[model samples]
Target: MSRHNIPDALWQRLEPLVCLPRKDPRGRPAKDARLMFNGVLWILRTGAPWRDLPAEFGPW
Candidate 1:
């Protein structure tokens, strides 16, 4: 995992809290919650703008 990623132990606790569906019945499928969470953490940790989020974490 990258530095921005949540550790496996922490993710196990967080995974249950994320309630988003993998597939959206009305539109595009939902993005991976773990990845999105990591992206958000990266921004918060780095104090960077959303536009600067790396591609590995998905779109900003």
Candidate 2:
């Protein structure tokens, strides 16, 4: 996890709140909610555009 990323305790709390991703017959496999949520958190925390998200976070 990144330095500014959500803590384990908070993540544990959020895990139950986050909806499980549905399987899309015609789409690629679903992404982990933790990773995607962290990506969103990074954008919100840094005020950066989705396209400008860091490489470490994977494709934008």
Whose lDDT is greatest here? 1
Query: What's the TM-score of every candidate structure?
Result: 0.77, 0.74
lDDT (tens digit, per residue) of candidate 1 on 1-60? 777788999999998888545564787654687888888888989999999999998887
Clashing pairs in 2: none
By TM-score, how accurate is candidate 2?
0.74
User: Whole-model Cα lDDT per candidate?
Assistant: 0.82, 0.81
Residue 19, candidate 2: alpha-carbon lDDT: 54
Off by over 4 Å in 2: 21-29
Prediction RMSDs, each to the true structure? 2.4, 2.1
> Which residue segments of model 1 deviate by more than 4 Å?
20-29
